[model samples]
Target chain A: MGLHFTNGYVRKKRLQIILLQMQHIIALTVLFHHSYQSKGEHLRMTNHSAPTLNELVSGVVDRLKSAGPLYYLLLLITLSLVIASAVIGLLAMFRGHEHYYNVTREIPWGILISTYVFFVVTSTGLCLVSSIGHVFGVQDFMPIAKRSVFLSIATILSGFFVIAFEIKIPWRMAIYNVISPNLTSNIWWMGTLYGVYLAFMFAEYLFLLMNKHNPAVICGFSGSVAGILAHSNLGAVFGLLMGRPYWQGPYMPIYFIASAMMTGCAVIIMFHILGYKINGEKMDGDMERALEVTTKVGIMLICVILFFTTWKLIAGAAGQPNGAYPVVMSEVAGHHAFSFWFWEILLGMVGPLVLFILSKGRNLKIMLIASISMIIGIFVMRFNLVYLGQSLPVYYDLGVNEFKEMLTYSPSIYEIIIAAGGFGMTAFFFLLGEKVFDGHKVEHH
Target chain B: MNKMDFNKLQNEGVENVPMQQRRDFLKMGLAITGIFAGGTLLSAASTFNKAQAADFAKKYPYSPHYSMVMRQDRCIDCERCMEACVATNHVPNVHGAYRTTILEKDTSDAIGSTKEFIPVLCNQCNLPQCTRVCPTKATYKDKTTGIVMMDIKKCIGCLTCQEGCPYNARYFNEEKKAVDKCNFCIDTRLARGEKDTACAHACPAGVRVFGDLSRQDSEVFKTVHQIEKAVWVLRPEAGTRPNVFYTKG
Candidate 1:
């Protein structure tokens, strides 16, 4: 009815008026900002300081000053652990994988694979979580984008370190995976996409470092897409196995992405708070608010994954389908029951959910305790996911003599050392990141 | 071989067969297989269920279409086939390095008292999960023979293929530093002009019958198509559509 009454001249005049109004609004905003800038008291009250170069340099120097004896001792220990893990990994590589590792023909994967999954899942989660702030322009998530991006790179690097030992000839893999590309292979896609994802992540991090907001946002978007693709492919690696019915469904790929986000939130809060403690600095107001929102997000995802786990258990145990039944039982009441119940269910899901609630997204101590517990619990969760799916014999229906029951695998000494070394790599790089990257401090867009 | 004999054989209840005769049949090395499949049994001459069995060779993508039919009831745990495979393939004599092995199953419910010995090897599936999961193309199906072969040099020993296989057929060969499974002795024997696999030749109970499925007249094809036997495969639900068939003669 409104359109029918208006003439072309009238519409044109109205459009011209809107354009003038938009310009007036922009001019008024600029004038307001300029007036605010002139008031030093107002600027100080708002805490939006564009520090001079001298002030910036002094601030960085101040941040680099020694914190305490305990901090130095922690750094020294983590670095030593990293060095020891690298040396052991190299020695095992030279000696041959089959000789040193407990991985056999039956149980071909071990703790190393699970630990790699744990680290990389956290990386993908961090990328996805940070993209909410940096790419999607969510104000509450802004403070974490820089720190999470740096930690994502560190965590993925740690993942690669552990996988280097698991993959017997990584150099050969580097050559063949490119020259002889298997388009249909899930592993090929996971590896290749992760490589692209890493490149994008590095570019995204570099852009963030240079304070190029637009370019950093674009890179973060690209990195998120790549991370989702790569992370889902990693899940497909387990899901696509026709023999492993426990993991042979959409549940794995879907569960992985959800779990990654959960892990991302956990690691982000844990490390950021820990980083603050290590530097003897407290979380400022904005950063504290960001963690509060992130904690709420963590609670939501914890519930999502808890739902996934419940369904996984229910479906796996119902019929005792060839490969799924025994695995579910093992996790529920069998040998892995303690780890599953105590670590995966109680500590990983319930404890964090409860603590996040009690903290109300503000209590640093409770949040810190919850985050640390969730990290350990989530590591065990990854281990169970990888191991339980394989613990059931492939030929369970065949009813063979040797495979009358479930198979068992315990991490060997070398595997344990390599896994510890992987953790050390994360710690070492994380400590260095805090110092070298100037505590990852910067203003959000 | 004729319709009259077939009719008479059907009229005689399967349970009427003398225990001594059955024992003698196994002893005389004619125990082709009890031909148990999906919990049903059939006699020797009628290896295939005529009404149900069809020419599945239409699905074969290779020229030679190499296949094996296991006469399951005939396997008596002699392990001669296992020895022959190791000797022929130069397979490492280790716990998990076998190219083939025998399995013992308790069939006490069905067979009254005797435990059944089953022979298992690489099915060389029409859609081999092992070949599909190998990131480096270290393990692959042959273009001409349909035999699942391996290029040990390309194997990175990730063991992903071993995990992908539903049958637990493939294993890491520590000697070769690669994943290895039954290739039907293609390189060691078949390429050198041998007509059959080492296990087929050494089977004292005629437990293994290996031949080309592409040739309708081949022993493997006839044994699979004779229509009287309920011929089937192990783990048919896996959807691998293996070239191997198992039946009791």
Candidate 2:
């Protein structure tokens, strides 16, 4: 009887151990599922909802049941596409086959390059804005400071995503940049500086979160200085190109900084308003102060932007030794005239500037409208900066047979889908943050 | 009662303190004030010294280095440079890309004398503004070659260089995520031990010439030295001190 009892007891113990191990495994799987689903599903769902401007501005989370399954399906499709793209890229590299999308001598830059710049610029702006509260002691900006830091980090990750997709040989770029850094190269400096800046920002934020014994004042100050330098360096990347007429200018650095400030402010304001709506929290004094400060900054930035535009046009109007005035005149009056005058100037600049001025930085309704307009306007500005700058010919007087035709660029569907995927990724990360971390914590009144 | 007696005795003894003690406290106060004032003066002087040491002129220029020297008399508005650039750079043949092209302006008759060709490129200059504003040091002048070469690998593609170059020489390559312009074909020619640039070599009429100004015996050096009368660089007002010289034929 004792022998039988011992056998039974051992069997029971073994069963218990197996059950415990199974539970632990299940728990880990659940964690993984949540992480993946948060980014994958939420992103797809948000895209599919075709969330209206109102929905976006209001921060409405769509009903999950209907959108959830579709999102999963979309996620699966996106994953497949990503895999296919990777495989194709690898095949091209290994087999030495020419990919159709490969930028040739005529069009050396394309959608991938443009997208990469967009993400990097946005990330730089985000980082700078986040640093303002901690570094500059901008008391009003404190409430959103942590959130801004998180967003900046997230944006930087997004930048990496676009760049990874853009480069034919990303590994080569990474290795070459470290080993064979050309000191005179603007691109090298930009990459190196931003890389360092990202590290610093991450460290600063981590220190803030960990409640480390380091002096907060010193950390903040150093981070701010680094952020400004990084952001300005990003602008210098374009400004340093004396060869590219459109990008060569002293005002570009100033313009870049101002615009970054504007965008950063807009993003914070929009996010704050959205967070408030989602959490059903009343707008507090700190939030109000943050909005007010951002509004004033945004308005001032607009004025600066106008000054830049006016001066650029006036200079271009003046005749050049090479009689280059026609190029400028055509830009102002020719085929690209619509984008320059309307999309860039009207929608991006004038529209937002007018809104901000009329709102007087007081009314939330007006501020909301102005913020949305500014964001859209900024996108237009980026597009113009990227596309218009490239639209001009480099050498005008080659032989008749050798005369190059006008350049053309239209983002392929794959490119557009990938861009959409980026947006999805952003939305997914944001929602996950809200869900897991309770990121929408209300500031004390 | 005994404690009260002692306290009263101590209180009575307070009058026995020295008057010099009061003067000592006052002297200490004055000494501190004097030290503070002296420190302030010292700090101010040091700040001024640092400011004097800073040479703002040598640091960076706020404007383009080379300005266009328009010789209106010689302009014939052939627009050859514009066409050639489009072909070479593969500039979108669309309306926007005209780095160097002709602009039509009627002298007397709106229809007849309406065009003039003006070749525009980076006016290599003494005080290139693009180099100064580059925060990342992405844009730099070659000490040996005197050519401003942009390394795309380092470029963050901010487009500030375009605004700084007065000649509108800088073009942002949307595809490359960097600025592109007439490097005088530095990557292809000068860097590869060639004598001249694609633009200079391609110009059939000898409208453009490329040579190192560093070599005193070079043709460019002798030409600038001999024909000092009519030779002018573009936009002398920009303070760029352009290397390219233009003469109305």
Best by TM-score: 1
Error of 2 at A106 (Å): 4.6
- Report the error of model 1 at residue A182, Å: 0.6
lDDT winner among the candidates? 1
Model 2: residue A386 alpha-carbon error in angstroms? 2.5
lDDT of 2 by residue, A1-445 (tens): 5334357779788789888686555333222111112322332222123433333222322323224454446556655554555554455444432233443333445555555565566666666775666567677766776567666666666666655655444565666667666665555566677777677666765555433325544555565566567667667666655445665567677777777776777766666676555434477777787778777777787777788878777777776523235446655887668767776677767877787778776677777776776766676567566655555444332211222334456665555545545544554555444433334332232
Mind giving the per-residue lDDT tens digits that candidate 1 earns over A101-189?
Answer: 88777788899999999999999999999899989989889999888998899899899999998887778788888888777788888
After TM-score superposition, the amount by which residue B38's alpha carbon in candidate 2 deviates from its true location, in angstroms, is 68
Q: Model 1 reproduces what portion of true contacts? A: 0.64
What's the TM-score, to 2 decimals, of chain B in model 1? 0.78
Give the whole-model CA lDDT for all candidates, comma-separated: 0.82, 0.56
TM-score of chain B of each: 0.78, 0.60
